[model samples]
Target chain A: MNPSAQHQDAEGARLGMWLFLFSELLMFGGLFVVFAVYLQRYPAQFADAGRQLSLFFGTGNTVLLLTSSLTVALAFEALRQNRQRLCQGLLGFTILAAGLFLVNKGLEWHAKFQHDLYPGSQTLRQAPAGQELFFGLYYLTTGLHGLHVIFGGVILSWVLVQVRQGRIIATRPTMLENGALYWHLVDVIWIFIFPLYYLLL
Target chain B: MGKVIQMGEYFRRGFLEPSGKQPALFDWIFSTDHKRIGLLYLYSICTFFAVGATIGLLIRLELIAPGRTIVGPQIYNALFTLHGVIMIFLFIIPGVPAAFGNFLLPLQIGARDVAFPRLNLLSWWLYIFGAIMALSALFGGGGAPDTGWTFYLPFAGETTTNVSLAVFGVFVLGFSSILTGLNFITTIHRMRAPGMTWSRLPLFIWSLYATAWVQVLATPILAITLVLILSERVLGLGLFDAARGGDPLMYQHLFWIYSHPAVYIMVLPPMGVVSEIIPVFARRPIFGYWFVAASSIAIAAAGSLVWGHHMFVSGMSDTAVLVFSLLTFIVAIPSAVKVFNWVATLYGGSIRLDAPMLFALTFVLLFSIGGLTGLILGSAATNVHVHDTHFVVGHFHYTMFGGGGFAFFAALHYWFPKFFGRMYNNRRATWAWGTMVIGFNLLYFSMMVVGMHGMPRRYYDYLPQFTHLNQIATIGSWILALGMALMAVNLLIALRRGQHVGANPWEAATLEWTVASPPPPENFEELPQVSHGPYDLKRAGEA
Candidate 1:
C-alpha cells in the first residue's frame, strides 16, 4: 500500500541523491572532455570565437550563479535552524538569481543571433571549420548548463513550498538539503564553464 | 503467472496479487512493488528480445547464401541496427539485473523493497517509454535509422532517417539505467537487515553491486553522447563531423567510454547468478569467496578503462592503443579468476546435475571461449586483423548470449520455483538447456571460425568462399530459435500447471528460501537475524 512504508532512511536518500548528482556531473564531464579536445585542436580560433562572446555578460552571469549558490546554502542552513521565513526568502532570491542568469543568457544569445554567430547560420557556415565547431561547443555546453539552472530553480522552489507547508521541517530536511546540493552543483558547473568559455586568456 | 487455481489452499497473496482498489492492469502498472516492477521488466524485455532475435535470425538467413537472400542492403542494414539496439539496450543490459536483481536484491538483502520503491517504479516506466520511443523510430516518418546502434557520426548526423528520435530514446533509457543503479546501490548500502554484513552477502548481490556502480557512473556518458548526437542532428552541429572541423574519433571515444563499461553492466550480474547458483548446487562454501567478490569489483573498475580497445582499428594513437590493449588483457584476469572459482566451486562437492547447474556449467564453457577470443582481439596485432570481422561478432554473442543470456535462463529456472511456488519439469528444462547450448555454440563458434578466415561482420551478403560457413551459422540460428521456443513453452506450461513447491525446494541455505514460496507481500513475516553465511553447507542437509 504505502510505497516507502517503513523503509525511510534520510541517509539513504542522501546517498541516492549524491549518486544521482555524480551521474549528472559525469554527463557534463563528458562534454568537458569533448570541449577540451576541440580546444586543443583549435586553440587560436577558439580564443577568437571566445572573444566574440560578451565578456561583460559572462562575468555578470558567473557572479549571479555564485551568489545564488551562497543563498541556497544559507537557505538550507536556515531551514535546519527552523528559520522557515529566512529559508523561504533565501530560496526565492536563489530562484530570482536563476531567472536573471537565464535573462542574461537570452540577451547574450540574441546578440549572437543578430551577428549571425549561432550554429547553422549562414555566417557560421561561411566561417572556418574550427570556429564553426567552437561556436557549436559553446552553444552546447552553455545551453546544457542553462537547462540545469532551470532545473535547479524548480527544485529549490519546490523545497521552499514544502518548507512553507511544514512538509519539510528541521526534523526532516533531506529534501531541502538535496535541493540545495543540486543548486550548488549548478553553480559549480558554471564556475568551470565561466573560465572554460570566457576567461580563456 | 502460475494462476494455479488448484493450489488455493497453499496460495498466499504474493506481490503478484494485485491490490484490491483498482483494476488488475492498473494496479500492476502503478504498483510500487519491486517484485512487480521486476516482472514488468521481465515481460517487456522478453517481447523486445523476441523481436531482436527474430531480426537476428533473418540477418543470419540473408547471410546464408550470397547476394540477394531475403532482403536488400538497406533493409538488411535496418535489420542489424534494430537487432543490436533492441538486444543491447532493451534486453541484455536490463535482462539479469532489472528482472532478477529487482526481484531478488531486496529479498536477498532482507529489505521490504529497494531503497526507493517509487523511484523503482519510475525506472520501469521510463524503460517502457524509452523502449517505445526506440521501437517507434522504425515506423515513424524518417524511416529506420541505418547508422547502426553505435550511431557514429557524421553519418548519424547526416542521415535522413529517425536518428534523432532513436538516439533521444536511448538517452531516456540511459536515465532509466542510472536510476536503477542508484536505487540498487542505496538499497545495498542502507537496507541490509541486521547482521547481513558485506562479506556474508550473496555473490549475486556483490555482482549487482559492481554492476550498479558501472551503471551509475558510466551510463551518463552514454546519455551525454546521445544528446550530442541529437544536437548534431537537430541543430546541424558538426561536433562529430570531421569535415566540419569535428573529430569522428571523439564520438567513438565518448560512446565506448560508456558502452565498454556497459559490457560489465550486462555480464556481471549473470556472473553473480552463476556464482550464486554454483555454490548452492555444489553444496559447499564458494571456493575463494573473497577473490570472487573482489573480482566483480575489479572487473567493473578495469572494464571502464578498456573502452579504447573498441576504437583500435577505427584509428587511434599507437600509444593509446598499446595502453588499452594492456588494460584489456588485464581486465581478463579478474574474469578468469571468477571462472576458475566457479569451477573450483563445482569440484569435489556433492554436485547436483539439475537444470540450473547444467546452464551454469555451460556458462563457464561458453563465456570462457568468448572471453579467451576477446584476448586475441584485445591484442593490437590480432585486433587489427579481425577488428570488424565476424570473430568479434562471435565473441560478443558468446559473452552476451552464452554468458549473460544463459545465466538469465538459469536464474529463471533457479528461482522460478521460489517465485511461483511451482516447479517446472526438470527433464524438459535440461533438454532445453542442451538444445540451447548446441545451437548457441554451433551458431557463434562457426562465426568465430569463419571470422578467423576473414569474414567481415554486418555484411548483407558475402563472397562465394564465405558462403558455406554462413549457411552453417544460419542453420545454427534455426536450432537456437527452436531451443528458445521450447524453453519458452516449457516455462509457460510450468507457470500454468507445474507441481506446487514449498519454501526451499532446492534446500539452498539463503534468506529467500527461509520464507514462504512466492514470498509474502512484505518478503519476511518477521525480520531475519542472520548469523550464518548464505551457503553454510553443513547447515543445509539433504532435501
Candidate 2:
C-alpha cells in the first residue's frame, strides 16, 4: 500500500478506537440507567445501603484513580518528548495505583462478606428479602468497575514494557494514547460509581 | 486495436484460477479484510437464520392444529421463545447490516476497507459464540429459556430453568451488535473517499449511519437491562420483581428502549437498499434525494424517543402514553416520506421490472401498509385493548417482514451480482418475488383481523370464535414458507447458473460498481478519488 494510504489507515484506526470508547460508555451507561431507575424505586434502601458502605475506601480509591489518570496523561506527554524511561516510570506508577484500588475493593467486599451481607447468606434474618437487593447491586456495579481496573492495569503494564523496549515512539504512540484514554475512562466511571455506591448518605 | 485481450479474456479470470483450495482457514479466522469478513458474517448469520427459521417452521406447523400436534405446550412455549430470540437477535437485527452492509459500505464509500477490520472480524465471531451459547442452553438441567425474548420479570427471575445462560448469550450478542455499529459509524465518518461528501453518499450508507448510531447508543441499555434480569434470577435480587418492591414496568421501559430502535436497525438498511435499487431500474435519479437521506436520520432519531409507545398500556402515566402515542405517529412521517419518494422516483421514468425493481416496488407497497397499520397501533385507546393481542404481532411482522423482509429481497437481488458476480434467472426471480409478496401479506395480514376480534398472541391455542382467522393465518404461513423455500432454491441455483456479471452490471453509478464483481482482496486496483455524488449516472462521462 502507499505510505499516504498507510497514514490514512492509521487515522481511521484512531477514530475507530474513539468510537469504540463511545460504545463502551453506552454499555456501562445501560447499567447506570438501571441504577437510576432502581434508585427512584428504592430511594430509602439505596441511600441506606450507601450509608453502610465504606466512604473512606471509596474516597481513597477515587483520589487514587484521579491521580493515576494524571500520571497516565503525563506518561503520554513523556512519550511525546521521547523520554522513554520517564514514560515507563509513569505507566508503572499508574499500574500500581490501579492495583491499590483493586486491593481496597477486595478488602471492602470481604468486610461485607464477613458481615454476612452477601446475597445468598442467611445471617441477615431481619428484612432479609429486599435487603439482598441492595447488596446485589453493590456487587454488580463495583464488580464490573473492578473488572475494568484489572483490565486497565494489564493494558498499562503492557504499555510500560513497550515503552521500555522503544516500541512506542513520539509520532507513533497510538498504543500509549489509547491506553491512557482507557485508564481515564476507568477513572471517569469511578467518578459516577462513587456517588451512586458510597456517597449520598 | 489494443493488442488483444477481449471480453472473454476478462470472463476467464473468475474461473480456472478460482483458487479451489480454501484460503488458509486462518484467512477466515483472522481476516482483517472487510469483504471476506463480510462474507464470513453473511455465512454465519445465514446459519443462524436457518436455525431460527427452522424453529419458526415448527411453530407454524404445530399451530396448524388447534391443539398440540407434534410437541406439547411447554415445549411449544420454549420453541416460540427461541424462535423470537434467534430471529430477532441473530438473524433480522444483523441481517442486511452486518452481512451486506459490511460487505458494501466501505466499497460504496470508496474506502479500501472499514475503519477497523479486525474488530469487524471479532464482531462476527462474538455473534457465533453467542449463538452457540444460546443453542447449548437447551441441554442444561432444565429446558432452554421458556420465557419470551423479553424475559419479563417474575417469570424470568423466579423461573427454575437455566435462564441465566440464555440471558448471558443475549448479552454477548448485544455486545457483538454494538461493536459492529461502532465500526460502521467510524468508517462512515473517517473513511469516505476524498470527494465523497456525506450528502453525496448513497442512501444505504445514510441508513447504516443512523442504524449504527442506534446500535452504539441503545444496545448497551439492553445489555445492562438483561444483566439486571440475569442477576435477579441467579442471586434472588429484587431489581424487577414487583412483589420484592421492584417495578416490572421498569424492565419494559428498559427493554423497549433498545428493542424499539432495534426495529429500525433491522429495516433502515433494507430501506437504503431499496432506495438504491429503485432509481437504477427506473432509469432516473432518485427524487427528493435529501428527503430520503433525511428520513433515515429522522427515523433513527425519532425512533429512539417513541419507545414509550410499547409501554402505553403497561400502567404508564396517561400523559406519558399520550406523548408517546403522538411521537409514534410523528415517527411514521419519515417512513411515509421515504415510501412516497420512492414511488415518485418511479413516476415519469422508464421502469424495468427486473427482480431487484420488483422487490423494491414490493417494498414500497408493503412498507406503506406496515407504516399505516403502525399508526393504528400507536393510538393509546387501540393499544390498550390490543396490547398483547395478535394485532401487535401482526403489526411487527408487517414492518419486519414487509419492510425488512422485502428490503432484504431488494438487496439480495440488487447485490447478488456484486456478491457472487452472477445474476439469477430473471423469470424465476420475478416468480419468487411475486409469491413472497402475496404469501407474506396473507400470512401476517390475516393475523391482524384475528387479533382485532380478540385473539391474544403468544397463546398455544385460541377460542373457536377466532378459529377461522387463525386457520387462514396458519394456511398462509405455509404459502409464505413455501415462497421462502423457493427464494432459497433460486438463490442457490444462481450461484452456478446465474448470468456472468460485469464490472457495472446495472450501469448504476456508485463507487462499488466501479470495481470488479466479488472484488479483489484489497477491494480496488487503485483507490478511487471521487469527484461527484454516487448516483450521478449522467455525469459518468464527465468523471
Candidate 3:
C-alpha cells in the first residue's frame, strides 16, 4: 500500500486547484472587461459579428467537454471502488472526448480562416470594423482554452501513468480527484464560452 | 586580543547573555527563521532608503538654481526615476511590513512563525534578486529607466531608454511582493495559536491581513501588465499599443489596478504602527478598536475599485471618470475614520510625548494635509487643474512621506529599544524631530504653492516665477537632510553610548515586550494565551 494510494490528500489537492481556478477566472476577467466595454460601445456590430460563430461546432465541443468531465468524475469513482481496469477505461473515454473537442475546434478555426475572418488577415482587413474585435476575442478565447486542453491532457496522462504504476488506489486517489477537479473547471469555462461566443447571437 | 575584549564585553552587556544566542554570519544567510529573515529585510530596506535618499539629494541640488546646475535634463530624468523606483519599490513597498510587521506580527499574534517560513526566506531572496536586476539597468545600453516608476507605455515601449530591463526587474519584484503577501495571508489564517481569534488578534496583524489581500489580488495584475509591456517592447504585443488598434488607456488601467491598492500596501502597516503606538502612549485601551481595525480592510477593498481615478484625464469614458471620482472620494472616508479614531484615542488621555509619539502626532497633521489635498484631486474639476502639476507631487510627498514615512520613523523610534536593547538621548531626538517637521513642510509646501501657480512637475528647470519657491524647497531639502542625518547619528550614538534599555521601556502592553529586549531565537518561552487587547495599558499597570 503506497502512501499515494490513499485518497486522503484529495481534499487538499482539490482545494488548491479550485483556488488556482479562481485566479484563472480573474485573469480572464480582465479580457472580459475589455470585451464588455467594447460590446457596449458597438452593440449592433458586435451582435452582427457574433452571429457568424458556428453554433453547431460550438455546441458539439461543449457537449464533448461536458461528457469528458462526467467520465473523469466516474474514473475517480472507479478508483474509489478499487476498480482499476474500469477506471482506466473511463479515463480513456475522457481522453477520447478531449480528442473530439480538438477536432471540432480545428474545423471551426479552419472554416473561419477560409472565410478570411482571422485577425490581421487580408480577409478581415475589409470586413466589418467590429468583426476584427470579434475575431480578436474569438482567437484569444479559443486559443487560451486550447492551451488549457493541452495542459489538461498532460495532467491526465500523468494521472494515467500513476494509475499504471498502481499509485492511484482507493485510499490514495488524491491525484485522480485533483485531475477531475481541473477537468471540471475546463468544462465549466467552456460552458460559459459556448453561450457567450456562439449562443449570444 | 583587542577584538576579543570588545566581543566579550558586548556579550556580557546582554549581547550573548540571552537574546544574543544567534549564530554567526552563516546562520544569517542560510537561516529560514522568520525573525532572522525579518532582520535581513530591515537591513536591506534601510540600505535602499539610503540609496534613494542619495538620489533625492541629487535632485534637490539640481533644482537649487533651476538651470541644470547639478546635471542635464537626461540625467535629471534618470535621477527622479531612480528616486521613485528605489523608494516606492525598495523602500516604501516593504517599509513597515518587512521591517516591523515581519518582526512583530507573529510574536504579537502568539504564533510560532509564519505558516510558510521557507517561503518567507524565498520572498526575501527574490526581493534581493529583483533589486540587483533593477540596479543592473544602470549598466545596460541605456542608463536606468526614465519612464517614471509608473512606466506608462508608448513612452515605456518606445522611450529609447533601458526600460525593458527595468520593467522586467519590476515584474520580478512584483512576484516577490506577491509571495510575501501570500505567505502572510496563510500565516494569519492558519498559524495563530489557540485563542488568538480575529477579535483578539493585534491590530498590526489586521493591517498585515488587509495588506496581504492587496498583495495577493492586485499584484498579479501588475505582473501581467508588466509582462504585457515587456512583450510589447521585445516582441511587439499590441496589448497597449495605440497604433496597432490597442488602447494606451488600458496600460493605465492595468498599472493603477495594482498601484492604487499599493498605496494601502504602503500605508496599512504604518496604520498598524499608529494603532500600536497610540495606545501605549495614551496609556489606555484604543478607543473604537473595531472601527480602526475595520477601516484598514475597508481601505484595501475600496482602494481597488478607485484605480480608475488615476485615468481621469487619460481619455477614459466620462462615465468611468465620474464613477471613479465618486469612488475615490468614497475611498478617503475610511482613512478619515482612522484619523478621527487616532485623535479620539488621544482625547482626555495622559499622552506621553516620546519621540515616537511626537512623530505620530506630526503624522496626524501631515496626513491630514495629504488627505485634504486628495479630496481636491477627487473632485473632477480641481483635478483637471492640478493633474500634472507640482501640486500632485506635494500631495504625494505629504501622503507617502508625511503619512507613511513619518509613521515608519515613529515605529522605528518606538521599537528601537525593543530591537536593540538600548535608549537614545531624548533631547537630540527632539531636536531632530523639530527640524524634520519644519523642513518637511517647507520642502513640500513650496511645491504646492508653485504647483498651484501652474507649474508642471518633473521639470529640470521652471519659469522664474517658480524660482523663489523652488529655491525655498531646495533649502528646505537641505534642512530635512540635516535632520535625517541627525537621526542617523542619534541612532548610532545610542547603539554605542546610550543607556541599556529594559524590555518594556515604554511600558508597552504587547506580547513582544513581555520577553527580552531582543527575544531569544524562539520568540517566547511559552506561547501565552492572549486575554486582553494589545492596548490594555491600564490593565498592564494594574498587574
Candidate 4:
C-alpha cells in the first residue's frame, strides 16, 4: 500500500479509538446513573458520606491528572514537530504525575480504611442504611477509575519506549496518539469522579 | 491492475498451503486470516452447542415423568443453569455473526480482511478463555451456578454455588463481544470496495452493522451489572442488597437493559441471513430493499427501550408498565415489516426449494409464531397470567432457536460449498430438516399449551396432569436429537468426501457467489466493482 492508504488506516484507528472511548464513558455512565439514583434516595446520608471523603486528596489528584493530560497532549505535539527529546520528557512527566495521583488516591483510601468505611467492614455493617449504599458506590466507582489510571500510566510508558525506538515518529504517530487519547480519558474520568465523590459535599 | 496481478500470484500459492517456516498447528491457531478465524469459531461454537444440547436432553428427560426420572432437583437446577448459560452466552449470541459474519463479511464487501485482523484474533482467544472459565465453574466450588443465566440477584448473591466465576467469565465474554462489534463497525465503515456504496450493500451487512451498534453500546451495561453481582458475592456490597437500602428491582432494570437488546444481537444477523437467502433462491429483486434495511436499524433502536417490559410483573409502577407495554408493541412493527417484505419477495418469482430456502421458509413461519406470541407476553395484563410459566420459555425458544437457529442452519448449508469447496448430500439434508422441524414444533408447541394450562417452567417434577404432554415433549426431544445427529453426520461426511463444487452453485447474485468456492487467501482475483444492488438477478444473469 501507499502512504495515503496508511493514512487511511490511521484514520480508521482513530475512529476505533473514539468508539472505544464511547464504551468507556458508558461503563462509568452506568455507575454515575447509579450514584444519581442513590443520591436522590438519600441526599442527607450521601452528603455525610461525601464529607467523609478527603477533599484535599481529591483536589490534589485532580490537579495531578489535569497536568498529566496536558503533558501527554504536549508530547503528541512534540512528536508532530519531530522534537523527540521534548516528547520523551513530557511523557515521563505524565507518568510521574499519574504515579503521584495514584499515591494520593492510596492515602485517601487508607484513611477511609482506618475509619472503617470500606464496604462490609464492621463499622460499615453498623452504618446507617443509606450510608452503606453510599460507601458501596464510592468504592466501586473510584476503584474502577483507579484501575484506569494504572492502565493509562502503563500504556504511556510503553509509548515512551516505542518513541525512543523511532517507531512512533511524526510520520507514524498513531500509537502515540492513541496512548495520549487514553491518558486524556483517564484524566477526564477523574474530573467527573472528583465532583461526584468529593466536591458534592 | 497491479492488485489483480498480485492476487493472481497468491491464487497460484493457494490459501490452504502452509509455508515452509511454520507448523500447521501454529499456522492455524495463530492465523489472523478472517476465514480461518471464522472456521475456528465454527468448530468451537459447534462443540459448545453439542454440550448444551446434551444438557437440554437431560432437562427434557427429567421433565418426562411427573417425578424425577433422570436427575435429582439439585442436579436438575444445575443442568438447566448450564444449559441456559451455554446456549445463550456461548452458542447462540456469537453463533451467526462470529462464524458467518467473520467468514462472509469481508468477502461480500470485497475486502481481504476486517479492519483490524489482529484484534479479531484476540477476540477469538478471549472467547476461548471465557468459555474455559465458564466450564471451570462446573468442576469447582459448590457445583455450577444454579442462579439461572439471568443471575437474578438475592439468590445469585446468596447462592453458595460458583456464581462469581461464571459471572466473571461472562464479563470476559462481554469484552470479546464488544471488540467484535468495534471491528465490524470499522470494517463496514472503511473497507467497502470502490463501487460498493452503502445503498448497494447486501442486507446481511446492514443487519450486522445494526447488530454491531447494539453490541458496542449495550454490552457495557451487562459488563457493569455482572461486575456488581461479582462484587456483591465477594465483597458483600449493598448495591443490590435490599437489606442495605439497595433495591433488587434496580438489578433487574440494569440486567434487562442490556439483555433485551441482546435479543436483537442474537437474532438480527440471522434475520439478515434469511433476507439474503430468500431473494436469491426465489430469483427476484428483494421487495422494498430500502424498507427491509431501514427496519433493521429501526428494530435495533426501538428494541433498546422496550426492556422494561420484562419487569412488568416484578411490581413496577402501573405507569411504568403502561409506558413499557406501549414501547414493546412499537418494537414489533419493524420485525413485522421484515417478515412482510420476505413473504412479498417470494411472490411471483421462480422459486427453488433448496435446503437453505426450506430453512429460510421455516424461519419465517417459526419466527412469526414467536413474534405473535411475544405480543401476549408483551402485554401487561397477559404477562401477569403467564409470567414465569413455560409459555415464556417456549416463546423465546421459538424466536431464538426456531428463528435464529434455523437461519444459522440455512446460512451453514447455503455457504457450505463456498466455504469448503464441497457439496453435502442434499437429500439427507432435506430429511434432517424435515424431522428437525417436526420435532421442534412438537416439543415447544406442547410446552406453550401446557403452560397455558398453568404448568410453570424450571420444575424438575410437575403435577400428574401435565405428565402426558411432558412425555410427548420428551419424545419430541429424542426425535430432535436424532435429526440433529443425522444433520451433523451428513455435514461431516460431506466435509470430508462430498463432491467438489464450482463457484456460484446456487446461481445467486451476491458478491460472495462471484468468487471461487473456498475463495483464495485474498478472496478475489480482482475486486469486482458493484454496478447494481445485491439482489439484482437480471444484472447477475447478464454477467
Best candidate according to TM-score: 1
To one decimal place, how large is model 3's interface RMSD in Å?
A: 6.5
DockQ of each: 0.78, 0.53, 0.13, 0.51
Candidate 3 segments whose C-alpha is farther than 4 A from its true place: A1-21, A42-201, B1-26, B242-244, B317-319, B424-427, B492-500, B541-543
lDDT of each: 0.89, 0.82, 0.80, 0.89
Provide the global lDDT of candidate 4 against the true structure: 0.89
Give the per-residue lDDT of model 1 (tens digit) for B164-214: 888988988999999999999999999998889998899999999999999
iRMS per model, in Å, is 1.2, 3.3, 6.5, 3.4
Q: Rank the candidates by TM-score, best first.
A: 1, 4, 2, 3
**True lDDT of residue B451, candidate 1:** 93
Docking class of 3: incorrect
Whose DockQ is higher: candidate 3's or candidate 4's? 4
lDDT tens digits by residue: candidate 2, B1-543 = 112244444443321123335666655666677777777877887778778878877876676667677888788889888989988888889999999998899889888788767678789889989888888877769887899888888788877777788889989999999989988988898888778888789999999999999998889888888878877876666767665556788788888998999989999998999989988888889899999999999999999999998887779999999999999999988988998898899899898988888888887787788788888889988888888888888888888878887787788888888887878888887887777777787778888888888888887876767767767777787787777788889989988877778878888888888877767666766778788776687764222
User: Stretches of candidate 2 above 4 Å error?
Assistant: A1-10, A120-125, A128-132, B1-9, B12-25, B540-543
Model 2 collision count = 0
> Which of 1 and 4 is ahead in DockQ?
1
Model 3 C-alpha lDDT versus the unseen true structure: 0.80
Sorted on DockQ, best first, the list reads 1, 2, 4, 3
Give the per-residue lDDT digits (tens) of candidate 4, residues B1-543.
112333253222235556547788777778888888898999999999999999999999899898869799888989999999999999999999999999999989888888888888899999999999998999886898898899999889998999988998999999999999999999999989888999989999999999999999999999989989988988888788888899899899889999999999999999999999999999999999999999999999999999999999888999999999999999899999999999999999999998999999999999999999999999999999998898998899999999999999999999999888789999999999999999999899999988998999888988999988888888999988998899999999998887777778888788888877777777876767877789998766322
lDDT of 3 by residue, B1-543 (tens): 012343354322322232234557656655666777787898899888989988998898888785778788888889899899999999999989887877787778776566556667778888988898888887768676788889988888888888888888887788788777766776676667667778877788899999987887888778767766776677554545554456778678878988989999998888888888888898778889899899999999999999887777888888988999999999889999998998899888898898999998888899999989998988888999899899999999999999889998898899888777779988899899999998999999998998999989788987877789988998998899899899889988998777766668898777788767665566665777777767877555221
RMSD of 2: 2.8
* CAPRI tier for the interface of model 2: medium
